[model samples]
Target: MRRSELVLLASFTLGLLTTRDAFAWCRTTTTQGFVPTSEKPCDDTGIPLYWSTRCVGFSVQRDASRWIDLATTRSVAQKSFDAWKNSSCPADPVSCTGSFDQGHPSIEVKDLGPVSCDCVEYNGKVGNANTIVFRDLAWTECDGTPKSDADTTLALTTVTFNTETGEIYDADMEVNTANNPITTDDPPGRVLYDFQSILTHEAGHFLGLAHTNLPQPTDKTKTPTMYARYEQREVYMRDLSNDDVCAICAAYPPNRSAPCDTTPRRGLALECGGGDPETTTKSGCGCMVLGQKPSGLDAVIVGATCLLGLGVVARRRRR
Candidate 1:
C-alpha cells in the first residue's frame, strides 16, 4: 500500500492519533493476519526484523570553516545515533536477542565536505545530493547573483532523510543559534532543529513506519510517537513503546509463530486498568461468581463498562 494509505489505515484502526501507542490495534485487523510463509518479505522469516536496515549511514556538513564547531556538531550527531541504536537493541538478552535474530541494518555518519550554492542546485529536496556540504552562505546568497552570493547564503538549511536511500542529510544555513552555544556567536552553529530529536523522528520513518494522524478529524488530540509534527522534547524518536515493538514484530514476525514473550504481546487486549484485559475480565467474572464483594466491585465496573461500550460498538458495526 502507499505510505499515505498505510497512515490512514493506522489512524482508523487505533481510534487515536498517538501512532506508536495506538499501533497495538493495527495487529487486530483481519488483513494483517499471517502472510503465507512463502510470501514473507524478508528472506529469513524465522527471525523478527531489525532497525539496522533502515538507517544505512549519515552525512554531516557546515558552512565555511568557522561557521560551526565540527567537534560539537559531530558529538551531538553521534550521541543521537547511538541513542537510537541502543534503544533498538537494548542490552537485555530477551529484547536484544530477538531483534538481532532479525536482519536489522546498522548506520554510520561521515563528515562530507562543505556545501556551496555556487556549484550546487537547491530544488528544496534532500537525499538528492549524495554528499551534504556546508556552505557559509545565507538565503540572500542564492537570491539572484551567483559568485558574490555564495559566501553569504546557506543552502538546504534543514535536516532531511531520504526514505529511498536510508540516508540522513543536513545543511547548516540560516539556523537560529540564539542560546545554543554549539552554533552561536563566532562562526555560528547553523543546525536547523535539535539534532538528536529530528534524527530520532527521521529514524522512525526509515524503519518502514509512516506518520500517524489523529483518527477523528475533530478530536484535536495528538497521536502517539509516530505523529508527523515534533512538539515535545521528551518525545524523542529513539524511544520505542510496547505498541512500536509489536508493530515491528507483526510486520516481521519470527519463524514458527514463536509469539512475543514480553508483557502484553500482540493479540492481547488492553485493559482500562493497565493490565491484560482478558485476564482481568476472566478473573473479575470469577470473583463475582464466587460471591466476592468490595474487591470485585472494580472488576464489575470494568465488565459493565466493557459491555456497554461493546454494545455501542456492536451497534455501530452493524450499521
Candidate 2:
C-alpha cells in the first residue's frame, strides 16, 4: 500500500484557526472539520475520537532510537506520558488563565517494556501492541513503505478508530530519527530536536487531540502542547500547558467509570501478523491481514512538522 494511504499527512500550512486559552482544546473527529450548527454550539461536535477504556498500554520498540539509547528512550517516553497522566484541572481560575473545567482525566498510561516489532500496526484478529517506534533508517508504513514527507516530519501518530462512534481502538507513535537529530540533553547548547518535547506533543495526539489553533497575537508562552508546529530547541511542549490540561480533562473527566486494560484491543502481539497473509482489508472497521492495510476501521494520522527554518503551520490529516 502507498504511504499516503497508510497515514494522513499533517501539512505545514496552518489555514484553520483554533481557539486558545481555557476553552481552546479540540478533539480528533471521524469527519474532519465537522462543527455542529447551533446558537449555543458545543465544542463536543461530531464524533470526537477517544478511547473507551481508562487504562492504556504503550510499548517502546526494542531497538529504540539510533540517536538515543534504549534506556533513555524508555525514560523519555515514560516522562512524556506522565506529563499528561498526572495533569489536573486548574485550581484557581485567576491564577490559571486558561482553566477550562474541573477534575483530572480518568486515565492511566503504562509502559509495557520493549517489544521486538517496530512496525506501526493494529491487528484485530489477534493481540496488538500500541507501540512507540523510532525510524532510524527511514520513515515508512508498517510494510516498510517510505512516507511522502519523511524528510520534513519530526513525528507522527497513527490512530485507528471506529468511524461510526469515534472510539479509538489502537494508536502507534513513530519518530523521525533518520532525518532529525533527536536529543534528550537538557538545555542543549546547540540547536537539536528535544525528544521529550516532541513525544509529549505526539502523546496528546495518541490521546485523541488535534493541533489546536490559536488566534494571532496570543501569548506565545502559553502555546498548547497540541499546537501544530515545533520550535526547534524549545522544551515547552514537554510540560502540559493550561490549555493542554483542559483538553485532557475534557476528554477523560475524573471519576469516569472505565476499566483499566493496558493490553491492545484484541490482545498483545509482539510482532505484526496474527491472521491471513494475502488478504487485506480497507473497509472501515475491519481486521488487517499481513502485507495489507487495515480494514473494518478508519485510521487518522496526525503529525508534527520539523521547524527547519521554514515558518509553516501544521494540521492533522485524516484517512
Query: lDDT values of the candidates?
Result: 0.30, 0.67
TM-score of each: 0.34, 0.74
Clashes of each: 22, 11
Q: Candidate 2: TM-score? A: 0.74
Candidate 1 at residue 87, lDDT?
38
Please report, as a residue range, the 10-residue window in candidate 1 with the lowest summed lDDT. Answer: 305-314
lDDT of 1 by residue, 179-235 (tens): 121132111333233344444444443333333322322422223334444432222
Instruction: Tell me how candidate 2 scores on lDDT.
Output: 0.67
State how far residue 77 of model 1 sits from its true place (Å).
2.3
lDDT by residue for model 2 (1-319), tens? 5776544333222212222243355666665333323332224555777889999988888888767888898888889988888887754422234444566688877898888887766665667788888888886666677765665688888776665677887788888888777788897455367788888898888888766654432565567777777777777778787767877777787768999888787777787754323233331212111223335333333211111111124432435
- lDDT comparing candidate 1 with the true structure: 0.30
